[model samples]
Target: MSEAGKANKARSGGRSGGRAARRTLRTTRDFRMLPGLTRNIPYCEVMDEAHVERLDNASMNILENVGVHFRDPIALEDWKTAGAKVVGERVFLDRGLVRELIRTIPAEFTYHARNPANNVRLGGPHSIFVPMTGAPFLRDLDNVRRNPMLEDLATFHKLAHMLPALHSTAHHIVEPYDHPISQRHLRITYSSMMHSDKMFMGMTTSPKNAEDVMEMCAILFGEDYLEDHPVTTGNCNGNSPLVWDETMLGAMRAFCRRNQPVLCSPFVLGGANTPASVPAAVAQLNAEALSALAYTQVIRKGCPAIYGHYLSTVSMRSGAPMAGTPEIGLMNFMIGQMARHYGVPWRTSGSLGGAKTFDAQAGYESASTLSAVIHAGANYIWHAAGWNEAGMHCSIAKFVVDAVQCAMAHRLGEGPKWDDFDQALSAVPDVGPGGHYLGHPHTQENFQSAFFMPELFDNNSIEQWVADGEKEITERALNHARNLLSEYQQPMLDVARDEALRDYIARREREIPAASELNQSY
Candidate 1:
């Protein structure tokens, strides 16, 4: 055999043997959290039969009582004919319609990322999806004030590129421009064309722009390619404290017709949007279900979708949504359980600690929130990192820190393996009452085998800390970020492809000189 063929055979054999060994080590273990601690509903104990019943009841109550308002006349009329009560702009959906809509949605679908590297398989028996960041900057890091503009499309792209946990990157923030709506759509187009190889989609405030962006993406990838690949997608945010409006619904429908996936995000703020209590939160979630599910069904039956629930506690004094609160963690857990009840895929935000610096508070909060989601078995997890100061600002430092936390979660999810277990047990046989296993062969084998996070907290002695000038977590993280950026090789866009992409961007820029100039200046 040729040398290359022999090498290939050896490599293939190694990989196959390794996988078989890992599989053999697997054991039945329940990684999910206890029922009450994880979700508002008794998901773990109730079994699939009872869970489905609860979901049905919840959907019924939402449709009959907490009707969603639709400003669009056509949509309102459609709902009215479908047994929904139309009170002027409001459409009260009944339980039957909700169930019908739920049935229309597909149980599983694939989300293609920028490249093959970004593509993710979503919706199965049990799976997990993680994203790097959430909505763009709501806070100003320098001034320490509410500054949404701090997060731009470019920043979003960069964050997406950096985040390993995030399966798909999102337009995390709003940008500043004269025509904010048009500019937002342009940004999505530019980012999708330039940054992602997989599925990339978002929604602007304007329905018209949303449709335009989707069209542009179709043109770029070709209509036939989009029908099959569906890389670019859109998000529909149901206004919390209320319901989805005409524009959002229209945008979602338009995209869905083109085979684009729509993420139905219901931003429910506890205490403000609903009641402060958990039950009230669940009730609000039911209302969200009615609205978001109806929109999905309205667009096209069985369209690719996600049950997105972003619930946070509101501070009475500040009127700001308190991220990383215990309430947020509980809500994420409950939402996952609810999604499981429906036998549909779920997506939820996480690791959003309302901290200004990359300190202990940031680490602890991120870890806690992420742990909840992992334990909940959420299929699609957003905001795995890159949130701080109540979802206001984007912290480069915190992003890296949260990434380490995400890695930790993935490791924990692996559970205990028997191969190592036997070795560990065998080595510990001689250890008794006062004896230690530190010197054992098993200890040596497993000690450093587990993933360990680099310390952001000061772990050195006083003398060493003082000598190192008492550097903070932010300093350490900043250094780490610099190293990563410096080491980052532009992922393989070959010469021909690179030239084609550049020319395309350049042509677009020339057509809109003013916007191009503005981007350059920024």
Candidate 2:
């Protein structure tokens, strides 16, 4: 045989053997969800120390001069008692008091999940990807956009449970229009608890709903256990332009009093809610978040809280909200710096897009937002999956693809792996000049872990792709999501506890007035 032919024959056995090993590895892979991401990469900082200090001073000025309105009478009283100057509802805070109150927020805390394996630490260098929440519509696997039902919401929980990338199946992936508005929170909480054991958020629509969610959680994880261990979180969105209403304040009180974490997120549409300039908008947002963080301390000294905000730019032409704008990315970096400066963990929106369909626009926008969130070192990344159409709908295909992107991001955030550096370097000499490492021992052994193999993305020869129906990413993602749903197993729950949760949900459903009896605006 020729020298080349001899070489080919010699490498054939190892190549085939390696292929078989990889196939087996893929087939028998365990899909347990990642507990969370611990970032080894340094955070991306947009603002230098001087810029950050300038923003800080600006925020303090806003808080001290213009002041924030504590529309809730209870909040006004709390701020007044906490030494803030209250003139009616508007409370002026001294920078010293803001810093003092913020000192109590723990830099990091363990968020307990029902399944111990899924418990995640939020804050510090840790990060958790939470599915998008509060979407009123859903684009189903069949690609039909419609108002979601309770079954749809439960299905999303199941998918999130099966997706190894997602850390939490956030409450209310999509609103269940078929259910009564008042009773929906109970069902949503029940669905989240039963479908996935991961840590999640609770309803903060009203104080009563927040209390009900807390009660349900207490049943799931004993009240005594909950007092010390922070479980679910409450998202208390502020009324932008420096205002905190009773609805949000009441809910914040409920969560803080129980020692649970609350995400004091301000929902801001730049140019409409705050100044058009990014710095001015961030300054205002910082003040709003600081005030809420301070309120958490007032609710109960040393309670857990997250500095959070959902920031978006407004289009000057249409007045519609824009996602994944450069301004938004800059804001994320600035916010992360400010949060670290305050020594508090922060949350931000991720995978956000304004596209109506899962097309190039959607992919570009989502990628931009997701990259920004990860780079900024956001601790709790909400809307990390399935956010589309300016947050109007959650797309199943987009959700699957976004989760895979998150897994990729998690791997990136972990930085470089040096465990097998020596072994990897050894392969270079084994394959001399003009040689490839395809059949090298080191290459075969590390191939799986060496690179991120996206489950949804197709990377194959044109002929192979053609043989497999030439599927688009959206279609392939939909098929993958269907398979995940089929394989999803409801997390184990004690029968007694499950019954208690159900019973509580039932009782609340009965006590709460039906949607028809009340206003439909909610």
Candidate 3:
């Protein structure tokens, strides 16, 4: 058994103490982490076959005629060697080449985790939830918004680890502002490794940082294991308006060469980054993503990659990016269709909101976005928790609530269980037409699995709620988070390997330039 498996087994086998100890044990028994879901339901398509074909033709036209900018000289040369028409930085691709290149990508790939049991498959009907990343500020336990510290980042990592619905502890849950930018990636990668045994994202701020992450992975999973298995993911977002810059290209090359999966995502703000029309914006994003995905094959043919984008509509009146808007949901449906049309796994944003607090607006907007992604058949759901204030702040209270919502959505994605229809109908006969089934034998046998009873939501009577202090959803979620943290047990790692990782971090910290000396922003 793995060290993490043995440790978790020993913890679960602890002897009980007094009544208080028994209560603590019962409260913290929520450590059942479900594996990545295999969705049985059909995808929700917003466009007809004709519409999808039209969008693909438009994307192909953009790639062939208009062309995309390849800012990296190496990328330009690769295209030039591949018979693409390269004019300086712009590379005009033939429709057949792009199609043939992407055909080599695997439809599904297993993302290995430290504990083998945590490994998740990406592509096909598989889906996994990952927490929000890149938030700069945090709405902490006390509900005060401020710049996050290293401690705050580690806290979110632990929360993500304990949350059963969350499958990956996506690196940099929030920016560790207190740390130096030059070395923050090192600490972020370390925290993710130490806090959770799940698969995580690699540091892609710079190619050097990305290489450092790969080395650390080698130390943890062994150099030989990494050569055959993909353990970490790298997210490379295109600098939109049909451009792939050097920074992102470098990161993609670093991970692709190592046989790791890269998410070729475009950060799209409608009207600002692309045309305001939803179809036009999707065509542009699809073209940009295809360009990057095709480039990954150029870096290493058969390298795992995901079709991804962050879609948000702009408020013309306020000039702010709008989350959970109808346009955003429409874009998600269209993107899912395109990804399926091209036979590739795709990713979409999750539970995003613009509310400053975990209020009605936050709940409504998050629900709107979550429902859309669940129905849209997104394979990898990012920002599944704690996203608020238009990606400005990550909220602790919101994080807990959003995780529960993810659990509900996960159940929805699995579709209905018709295998028990006969047994369910037996209850109908057991009780007369006008009778109740509360006491039926079938109800007694299957009541627990029949319905998804959410632990965080309160459906009690008003008097009972008031008698129990009448706490709101935010307070309940905060309390649940506290309980989960109090019971968190660190996953085990090899003592020698742990030391080696720390030594590598310390050595790199001394070698890397200081934040002031660095020329690029992370």
Q: Please write out the lDDT profile of model 3 over residues 207-295, one tens digit for every residue.
A: 77788888899899988887679999899999889999888899889899989988999999999999989999999999999999999
lDDT ranking of the models:
2, 3, 1
TM-score comparison, 1 vs 2, better candidate: 2
Alpha-carbon TM-score of each model against the true structure: 0.76, 0.96, 0.93
lDDT of 2 by residue, 1-522 (tens): 899776766566356665655674666446698869999998999888999999999999999999999888888888878899999889999999999999999999999999999999999999999999999999999999999999999989998888888999899999998888888889999999999988888999888889998999999999998889999999999999999998899999989999999999999999999998999999999999999998899889898999999989999999999998999999999999999999999999989999999999999999998998899999999999999999999999999899999999999899999999898998888899766676677777777889888878886556879999999999999998888877777888899999999899888777777964372223
In candidate 3, what residue range of length 10 has the lowest lDDT sum? 15-24
Q: Of the candidates shown, which would achieve the greatest TM-score relative to the real structure? A: 2
Which regions of candidate 1 deviate over 4 angstroms?
1-59, 80-83, 124-156, 173-181, 196-201, 219-221, 230-233, 424-426, 429-448, 455-469, 494-522
Between prediction 1 and prediction 2, the one with superior lDDT is 2
lDDT per residue as tens, model 1, 73-121: 7677777666778898777776767767877776676665546655666
Which residue runs of candidate 2 sit more than 4 Å off their true CA positions?
A: 1-21, 516-522
Relative to the true structure, how large is the alpha-carbon lDDT of every model?
Answer: 0.61, 0.91, 0.89
What alpha-carbon RMSD in Å does predicted model 2 have with respect to the real structure? 3.6
